[model samples]
Target: MESMMSFASDLKSVSPLTSGCALIGGVVVLLFIKKVAISAYKTFLRPAIDFTKLGKWAVVTGATDGIGKAYAFELAKRGVNVVIISRTESKLEAVKKEIDDKKYGVEVKYVVCDYGKFDTKARDMIAKELEGLEIGVLINNVGASYRYPRYFHELPKEEIQHLLTMNVDSTVWMTEMVLKGMVERKKGAIVNLSSAAARYTQPLLAEYGACKSFIEKFSCSLNAEYSGKGITCQCQAPFFVATKLAKMRKSWSVPTPEEYCAQGIKWIGYPDDIVSPFWIHATAGWVLLTIPQALTTAHFTQVLGGLRKRGIAKDANGGVSPQKTKKN
Candidate 1:
């Protein structure tokens, strides 16, 4: 009976200890779960793109029209002075005037230079114009694809060369020019305009897509390298934007340039792998990564190519009809 009593006492004494251990375990598990939940919320539920923190001057190439123009307007709205670059002096003047009249408390400057051909004189001219100004943001937005719908081989060599110069070479040179200053200052942001076609292999825009892919990869890698130095770089790969360029295409999803640019600029300060409205599409590549690559590529090509052919694409002048291309 004494032994029995002793055993009961021992069990009773250990019961509290066991209970305490269980409680501690439960609390530890709960804390771990809470941490995981927070991480997940920040990773998935939060907005992927954000640029509300930027408050410096921004330079946008091809800023007179389409997404570029929208970027300029959005940046100005965010209290950033703008340096607009493009070939058309009249268009640049008009855009500058509008921005000035809007009284956004931001300065707007214009640089009229063609990117189709690399001219040392033109580069020097642009450098001189930007010599004294401090540019906090550099947007490599100027690009070109084949205007008329044609097979890769069907396009003229000159046209292809021009496209390469504008889309790839010019972007590289401009980035080099600005990045030097950015690296020296240890502060800057660069946003390059890539395309959804960069990921998918298409029949018509083979070179154009390839060039964009280069931009996307280059910007991402560069971002990784410079992020430690207070510099951020992003390559945006949006689907068809309503622009004069999109009008020449037969079909595209065709978001307004304003909508695209708004989202893009918003993403400049946001943390994410890439910034693209196309991600919201149910059938987009990012959503369907588990599917076969060949099938995804085919679908993208057909849908986007069809849109280009239909002339339903958007442009800088807004959503005008196909016949009204020259009017803008």
Candidate 2:
């Protein structure tokens, strides 16, 4: 009987520790289940919010090609009047004609302003064109990235200036132009095109990644500040979309611009501040989070270093970079 009592006391001694561990495990399982449920619902069940409710006119910057062009087409197809802005007048006219041919029954306007200029004159020109339009949605899609990854010191001063002006300045100034009207109207959706690079400490692509990170942070903060006013500010962080900027071909992992924009437009006016609109991209993003940060950084460094070497070799061979060969 004395021996049995001793055994019972030992069991009681470790019971609290076991109970604590089990409680923690249970909580973790519950959290995981909740996250999965939410993702499933967002991916499959939630109806796309009606963008027409926000306003009559939607403006897309960098609308001459790639993702911006795709967004313009998608919005017009959905019966929204679209103002497509880009640096080149010829390409804008071409896109406008294409939209007209589709006969989506929506007006398509074009604004010619080089976001790279980022000057008061450029701003005034855009402002003048946008005036008197009930601007509902603004897609801040205009941005610049490196032709090829390079060490920070090796990048040209001119390239750095262009990056700052095109990516950062344009987003801020364009938002300033439209946000007041949005606030007064009490309904708007601003979609800023960020990149998955923003999620990493990209080694050779440092400045480009940093600029995208700024967009992500800016969108999140703006959403927090104005969501109560019925304005949805969102930053889309897509990975490897097949576009002129990426110089990548379409695949299951890398979607075509049309495929991406189709999935992308569904996300507007939702509450999430930063999103990977495509479900595959979202899954890839989540998988990336599970990898150790050090590993991910080292992997990016190695991959980008290889690209830098190839780029330099191409330059030595008197070849133009793909980025320079085609306008993004």
For this target, which candidate reaches the highest lDDT against the unseen true structure?
2
Residue by residue across 291-318, what tens digits does model 1's lDDT show? 7889877876776577556532543336
lDDT of 2 by residue, 86-110 (tens): 9899999999999999999999999
Runs with alpha carbons beyond 4 Å of true place in candidate 1: 1-55, 248-253, 271-273, 277-283, 300-328
Clashing pairs in 2: none
Span of ten consecutive residues with least summed lDDT in model 1: 46-55
Error of 2 at 288 (Å): 1.3
List TM-scores for all candidates, in order.
0.74, 0.93
RMSD of 2: 4.3
